[model samples]
Every structure is written in structure tokens, then in C-alpha cells.
Target: MINLYEVQETNKMIEESNLDVRTITMGISLLDCCDTDVDKVCENIYNKITTQAKNLVSTGCEIENEFGIPIVNKRISVTPISLVGGSCCKTTDDYVKIAKALDRAALEVGVNFLGGYSALVSKGMTDSDRLLIESIPKALASTERVCSSVNVGSTKTGIDMDAVKLLGEKILETAELTKDADSLGCAKLVVFCNAPDDNPFMAGAFHGVTEGDAVINVGVSGPGVVKRALEKVRGEDFGTLCETIKKTAFKVTRVGQLVAQEASKRLNVPFGIIDLSLAPTPAVGDSVAEILEEIGLESVGAPGTTAALALLNDQVKKGGVMASSYVGGLSGAFIPVSEDQGMIDAVEANALTLEKLEAMTCVCSVGLDMIAIPGDTKATTISGIIADEMAIGMINQKTTAVRLIPVIGKDVGEMVEFGGLLGYAPVMPVNRFGCDAFVNRGGRIPAPIHSFKN
Candidate 1:
């Protein structure tokens, strides 16, 4: 428990291997803020968020300085706005007022991003849920530091085709509303199947109704650390490769445990789970694709790519569980095209396509993330894509999400830049096909047979 060598090794991992805590997120419940008047609802949300997260940023900075470990972002997540404003928010504009209030509170508290502008309509949509879903394009276009997500499917409730079809149009509207910024608003909106309650990552995080009033969740990432460890066992057998990744993951997660404990104690909040995802960045050598390449793949979309990803995802979870008692969220490998340089390179080389990426999500942490498509693509096609991903999550009982941006005034082979951690992406081509007849058949897809285990 008291050793100098372990501390020194952690420092080396930080300095050379790009190891760091990705986010320290505070999940604040807004259920008590509901009111009959829209104005009062907004006031309660603003006051609660600002008062609760007042010291979040400063505490994160203090931890970074005292421990010499970099904490990338301090953020917040709240109860789904649809539930919080159900009694008061009568119209789309009323829901958007709450969105503005959330953005204001985030700015005042000095957090990087605030999530939970969301509705959970897995089976069907209530009036409040429909209003919030309708307000997403305006809500995201009008706010900064506020992110939104909608859960359209779950293993128990099955998929909601109505919500999927509606969100297809809303995503396109969001792209048009923020076209001046390269359709950046859509980047802040995500559609999920089996979305987790305690996720600390942006654009998909929400404080589930099952959570306590307020808690602290930390997300830790270290793709570079894993890659460097693999290099040491480059020519070794499969058993050696697996062991190295497991041991390396254990060490990296310990650092996250330290940071989460410190942040919780200092902020007077209960400690939540640690999300040990291999979330890559645009920086050099900090890529999940590079890790796959290190695992002997020529490129990310080659014949054996999905197998390598499946192996990497399983091992990451195996070692992460051993390191922490409470491991939750999407705690596996992420394959965002824009965020990882190697993935971007693969796309430029015509090695990765949308179809291959969809196949990969069957095993990866999240599905079809941070991908840019052409503007002229039809809304039904987008809905079709969403339905396909939802089917995967529903069948496998895993959490999967889609964050697609139909960048306006751009086509395939063109580039769209979303600077600073939300990296740039090459606009990938989508299959020119029609699915209007299928998505228009608007009803829930019944849950799979295994879901009736109860």
C-alpha cells in the first residue's frame, strides 16, 4: 500500500504513455425540481445544479496539482429533462427553456459539458417525452456546454420505431440549424439502445431515476498505456499477450481509483463506479485502432479486425473488474472515427467503411460513434441505420449508441473539423438505398424471446 516504485511507474505511464483520468462527472438528480410552472421548473434546475457543482472544477484542478495526475474534464449529468419538466413543459419551446437553464448552470459552475437533456422512450412515448424529443434540434442548436441523448430501445422493452424515425428527422434538423459550425449540434446529440444510468461520458450520460441524489463517477482512459504494454510482448504467444494487457489494465485502473476517492472525499459526494474504457484521442499514439494494429491487424477493417476487437474488449473488461469493485458504464474499447487518428487514417486509405464499423460495434463499447455522413442522405436511411444498431443491442443485451452527423454542404471524401478533443473526420459515404417503407411501419419491435426470463 505504501511503495515508491509503484508511484514512479504510474508517473512514467502518465508522462510517456498518455495515461490520464478522462472525466470526473457529478450526477445530480433534478426530480425534486419539477413544478407546474415552466419558469419555476427552470429556476429550480439552475439553482440546484449551480449550488451542487460549485466546487467541481476547482477540486479537479486541485487533485491534478496535488497528485501530479492530469484530470481532463469535470462535468455534470442530471435526471432526464423529460421527467423533470413533465408537469410544466407543455410545448417544445417550454422544454427548450429548460435546456437554456441547464446550459447557464453549466457555464456558471465552470464545467466542460453537462448531459441529460434526454427522454427514455424505449417502448412508447408519453406527451412529455415526445415534446422533449421534438425540442432536441432547437435545444442543442441554441445552447453551449449542454449535450442531449435519447434512449430509443432496451432489452426489456424492445425498440421504438416511432422514436427512431422521429430522431432521424431531428438529427437532420440539428445539422441544418448548426450548419455554420459544420453541423456541430448533431455531435452533441446521441441516440442509444440500452443506455446506462451512471455513464459519465458526454452526449450519452444521464442520471438514471434509480441513482441517489448526487454521486461522483470517474471515467479513466489509457489506450497508449495498453499499446506500450503490448509492444513489450510483440513476438510472444497469445497467453502472454492476454496477460500483459490484463496486468497493464490493472495498474491503469488503480490510478483512477485514487482520483475518484480523492474527488469524492473533497467534494463531499459519494463515490460511484469507475469507467475504465480505452477511450482514444486525436493525439499521436493514443488510438484504439493503433492498439488493434499492434494486435497484428494490417488495418482496422481487415478480415480479422472484428475478432481482434472482441478480444481487446473482453480483456479490458476482465482486468478492469479485478481492479475495482464497482465497474460500470461503457467500459470497453471505443472506435470513433474522428477521435482516433489511426481510424481516420484507415478511412482515408479506404480500409474502413460504415458496414465494417457496424459489424465491429457488435463487440466494441459503443456503436457508430462520432461518424460524419453526407447531408443529402435521406432521413429514412438514417432511421434504418438506427434500427439496425438498436437490433444489435436489444439482441445481445449490451449498451450501444449512435452519434451520426449529416454535415451540411459536405459529401464523401470531404473533411469536417471539430477541433479540441472532438477531432476531425472524413465524410464517409453511406449506401445509396431506400428504407422508407420499413421505417414508416411505426410500432415497437417486440423484445427477443430471451428477454422473457422473468
Candidate 2:
């Protein structure tokens, strides 16, 4: 089945197309580690995580070397700390302690990041959920390599306006606390609607209660590969364009499937899924926006951009599904502004706005990711942005998320650099309109009529 040309083609994809395994994530369950005593729970967590992920880093490296493929990161995701510490953590300080423990474990395992400091409060917040929401500011500010997320809406539960409003204030507080770092803490936190449990990507990944004790998930990305394939069909009809993308996606996802199987067997853990998302990077040629342009769009955010994105997203899924039976997570094209170089350029050109980006999310994986806004923007306005996004996901019954970074002391056109994968972005201006009254009158927005499936 494997031929010399196939081998050569794959090598070219890695060597030039910037194709690589974005992450090999080990998801460990911390449900059994929960204890009524906060410190005791921390000890259990640190022990369990370190023990389970001890070989994760080395295994990832071994695979990369053997296959001659580049694996960018080896990471870990665990049961939500909110659930693990909810019963015992009485204050924000208590939650910060757990974050520190998680950070320590990540350092020991040699993984760059650890996720699942999260709470799910789509309909209502429990006492513990409220505690975790309040603690996010201090918890993220104090820890390194620990990523957090909160689910504030879902198709079945509707939007939790109470949590959304609180999160706006908490996001501002987090920025203030980490102002010296260019409000870098907000980059590690994500707010979501219909957040996926099996996502291998960070800032949103949490080992859900539905998962097994341990598993391995692989996220594959290849914007450059897709772009290169499209070049062969330049000026092609829409029919030709769709086929080119789908065939290219099939090849990209096959690599991910091989990596996932190898990791699961080596770790003696069950294999989870392959997430074939076209996640772009800050690197010049490795951009999803470039792929859109290759498909005939002058620039992303121009009219027809959404239709171009929709075609790409749908084809990626069609091709990927046939390659792997167990495909899950946010398996579509990602449009994170800061992380993608083309998006940054689009924003700089004034071709893209927050409102237009919101429309794109209707077809992309996540919404408002790594987007930097002016520090002077009001919390109420942030809440309004989130409410609109949540409404989109809730109605469509799809997974969507928001990760807006409000840069402290930075106004529009000012740049904030978080470097590395978090990249840098110019602070965009938020509309100076008031949404205080709507955000302040907090209550749950009832689930859509379609949610009554059972």
C-alpha cells in the first residue's frame, strides 16, 4: 500500500509544506483524585498527572524521529480542576493552589502546557462553578503552562448570561493582574459554547467526564499543504476546487491517524480521535488565509470569504471522515487572529473587523480566538460580543469558543506581543457603544425549541 512516491510526497509536505503534528495530547482523568481537603486533592492531582504523563514527552519525540515528522508540541489535558477542587476550594486562593500544582506537574513531564482548569456552566452555575469563575483571574495570573476554559452556553442548555457577565469582569481583572506581561494571562483562558471534550488543542481542551480514565488525541494541521494543492488547480471551477481540497485533506489526515495509533499503543492507553483541523501558524507560508487567497479571494474578510471558508471546512471533514473512523474535537479550519499571520495582516489592512470575524466563526472551528482589543473596552461590551457568539453556536448546535485578549494600557493600533505560538497582535478598537443594561439583567436564555430531542 505504501509506495516510494507516497513517501516522497509526505516528506515534501513536512520539509516544505509546513505539515506537522501540532500536538500529541494525553488526557488524564482527575475525577478520582478529588478530595474534600484542598491540599490533599492537590497532592493527588500532582501525583496522578506526573505518573500518567511521565513517558508522554519521550514517546512523542521517539515518533517524530522514527517517522522523520515534526511534532511541534507534547501536551496534557486533565479533568476540569473546577470539578476536582470544587467541593474543597472555598476561595480564589484555594483554586490558585491547584493551578500551581498543575503547573509543577507539567514542568516535571516536560510538556509545554497543561489544560482543563475549566468549569461548565451553560445553564446555571453551581456554588463551585461560581467559585472557579471568580478564581480564574488569580489562578491564571499565578500559574505558568496551565490553560483554562469555561463553557457558558450549549444547544441543549442555552446561554448562561450570569456567567458571561462575570467572565467579562474576570477577563479584565486577569489582564490587569498580568499587565506587565502584556496581559498574556488572557491568552491562556478561553470561553466557549458547546466546547468539545476531546479537543487536543489547548486553551480549551478538558478531559470530559464522559471520557475514559486515560486516552491519546492527535491534532493534525496542514494549511500549507492545502495551499500548495490548490495552486495546481489555479483558476479552476468550483467543482475542481472542492475536489482539490478534499483530496489534499485526506492525505493530511492519514498522517494524523498513523501518529495517534502509534501513541496509543506505546502508551498502553486507548486511542481517542484524530482532529484534522487546518490550524495555521505565524510562519509566512503556513497560513489558512493564504489558502483562501489561493482559492480566488483577494483577502480574507472580503465578501465571498465566508463561502470560501465554508467550502474548505466542509471538504476537510468529508475527506477526513473517510480516512479515520474516530474523528472528533474541533475538526475544522481554525481562524485564530493572533496565531495566524495572514489574519494579523488582514486586521492590519482594515479588511477584517470583529464583526466580520464573528461571521466567519459560523463556518470555522472557534470564535474570537487570541483577538486583542483595546484595554479601555468595557466589560459590558465584551459580554455583548460573547452573547452574540453563543447565540450563533446555540442555534446551530455546533462547538464555538471565544478567547479575547484585552491588552492593558494599549489602545487601537498599538501592538502587544505574547511571542511563540501565542504570537502578537495590534490592539483593535471595540465599538464604544453601551450594552450594560442587557448584560446586567442576567439570566439564562432558554434553550432553542430544537433542543427537545428526547
Candidate 3:
């Protein structure tokens, strides 16, 4: 039932490649933590996170040591604060207070990031959603660890053009607000289509209504490992390549499940999901682009790259689903430009463009991530990007997102460094021909025919 040589080869790849788990995120639902009083609500939120997630870091570290595999980030995602505080918070300041509390809780628990300061305005925005989006800049600027997101579209609901327009303006405002902080606020915010509540990834993760009140969702990443596997099988047939990737993904996802179970047991939180996304880092050897290269592309964005990625993504899900009973979130291979060194290199070499990247997202995980564009790019163009990605997700019925940064004072081919995990990206050019009329239509793109199934 197994190939020892193949397993040994994959192990060698894991050792040589800079592969590691990207994050072990504990999803703590705060619905039960809600209250009519603002102070009481904040207290409940704080208590729930602190109590349920107290041992998250330690457990993650123990798993790392026990398995000899690095776990890069220990984090938490809670129910969208806007929804939890809807009945209690009357104004923007009330939401800000809750965000500050989340920041403090994250600091106290020793986690790097805490997500779910978010709202789902895909169909329409409520008063609470408006206040939450309005306060994102202030909340992000004031708090160090808190992250935010807004879901502007989904498969069944179609694109919320109004929400997309507002988020476009919010992106510019957020970038401007944190320009002095290297646009760090924008780094912490992600605008998503078909956003998942159980996602364990940063800047966009949140505990959705369907998830348990308190649970652990682990995100396993190892693009380097996958690349190395592909390298050893160079010149091999496509069937062999697919099998190799599937076997490797089984190993990676198994590690994730083990760590998630241990962390959940130690923290007294229910285990949620294993997101088997091959999330990359800025470091060498750990790159989704490298996997593409190993899969026969001279560089990412080359011809046939999409087909290779589609096979890779499908194989990963197949292996992960078999490895664990519970698998959710945006699980596949992430191709964030700045976050992956290979992707950054590809962009610099003129091998990749925004359009190509968008095309790739149709087959990959997490659409149009960490992309930097000229500051002068119109709001409508940015909205156009979101619209395009959302359309893909709606049509395909999968999770996709756009986290493009309109770096202020930055131009095409220029670089804006966010430093550290956020990494750096060259400002890619946008379409000169405006999408004004398309965006100005300002109405929902009706859900696809497929979504009408009873």
C-alpha cells in the first residue's frame, strides 16, 4: 500500500527544503460570550479566548519539539466581533474597545495574531458591519496583534457590489492610515469572497457560525517539501508526479492532525479542522512557485502552470481528506506574491503579472494575496480585482479572496517592503483601461445557475 523509496525521498525533501507548518490556529467562537452590555461583552470575549486558548502556544511548541517539525505561528480566531457585539455596541468606539481587548488577549496568551475582527457584508451591510469596517484603521493602528476581514461575496449570494465599493475605499484609507507603519494595517486586513469561518490562516481567519464554540483549526504548510518531491521525480510521468504529491500531502496533513489534536487536548478546546494549504514564507526553499517550477514550469506564470497547480491542489485535498476526518478552510496551495520568495523573484523577472496571478488563483488557494499595486490605481480597479476573484469563487463554489495593496507613493515595478512575515512585493501594474463602467454598474452579479440546485 506504500512506496518506501518514495517516502524516503519525501523525507529527504522535507529535510533539505525549508518546509514547516505555517500556523496552528484555535478557533474560539464567541457567540456565547455576547451580552447586551458593552463591558460585559468585552469581558466575556476576553475570558473565552484567554481560558480556552491559554495553552495554545505551549502545546504547539511541544508538538513542534516532539515531531521535530517547526510550527511557525500559534494564533486564534474568534467569532466576528461585529456580530458578537452587534446588540451591545452602539458606536464605533464600542467596537474599538472590543478590538483592544482582543489585542490584549492575544498579547497575554503569547500568540502572534488574533483574527475575527470582521463582518460578513456579502449580501448587505448592517449598522454594526458599517461601524466595524469604519473602525478597522483605528483598531489596527492601535492594536498590534488584532486582524480584520470583510466578506463581500459568496457562491450562493453573488457579489455585493456596494460592499465591494466600500471595501475598495476602506483599503485605500487603511493603507493611508498605516503608511507610516509600513502599511502594516493593510497587512492585517483581508477582503474575501466565500470567506471561511474555520480558516486558520492569518489576516482573514475567523470562527464562523457553523463551527463549535471553541475549537482548534490547524493550517499545515510545506511547499518546499512538495517541490522537493517533484524534483526527485523529474522526467517522471504525470501519474507518478500526482501520486508523489498525494503521498507527500498525506504525510504533511497527518502531522497537522496530530498537532491539532494535541493542542486541542492540552488547551481543552475541541479540535476543528486541518487546513492543508501549502502556505509559503519569504525564506528560501519554502515557496509555492518552486513547486510550480519543479512541476515543469521554468517559472511560475508560464504556460501549463495552471494545469500543474490544479493537479497539485486536487491531490493535496485528496490526501488531506483521507488523512483526517475533519478538513475545512481554504485548503490548497497558496500563491501569495510577497510571502513567497520564489513568487517575488518571478514578479521581478517579469515572469508574473497581476492578470496572470488572477488566472492562477482560479486553480489555487487564496486568490490574489499580498499583491502590491501602484498607489494611483483607481479604487474602481481595486474593486475590479475583488469582483473578478469573487466571480471566480461564486462560479466555482470555492473560497477565494483579494488582498491587493495599493501602496501609497509606490509605482509599478517598484518595491514596498512590509518587512518580516508580511514580506515585500514589487508594485505590479494594473489595467490602464478603466473598469469604471463595469464597476459602476453597482449591482449584484446574480448567483450562478449551478447554485440553484435544491
Off by over 4 Å in 2: none
Q: What is the lDDT of candidate 3?
A: 0.86
Ten-residue stretch with the least lDDT total in model 1: 235-244
Better of 1 and 2 by lDDT: 1
Where does candidate 1 clash, by residue pair? none
Residues 371-391, candidate 3, lDDT per residue (tens digit)?
888877788888888899999
Residues forming the 10-long window of minimal summed lDDT in candidate 3: 5-14
lDDT tens string, model 1, 1-454?
Answer: 9399999999999999999999999999999999999999999999999999999999999999999999999999999999999999889999999999999999999998999999999999999999999999999999999999999999999999999999999999999999999999999999999999999999899999999999999999999999999998898888898888888888888899999999999999999999999999999989999999999999989999999999899999899999999899899999999999999999999999999999999999999999999998899999999999999999999999999999999999999999988999999999998999999999999999899987
Report the lDDT tens digits of candidate 2 across residue range 1-454: 8799989999999998999999999999999998899999989999999999999999999999999989999999999888899889998889989999999999999999999999999989988889988989998998889999999999999999999999999999999999999999999999999999999998899999999999999999999999999999999799999998899899999999999999999999999999999999899888988998898888898999999999999999998988899999999899988888998999999988998999999988878889999988898998888899999999999998889999989999988899998888988878898999999998999999999999
Query: Which one wins by TM-score: 2 or 3?
Result: 2
lDDT of 2: 0.92
Clashes of each: 0, 0, 0
Residue 83, candidate 3: Cα error in Å is: 0.8
Ranking the candidates on lDDT from highest down gives 1, 2, 3
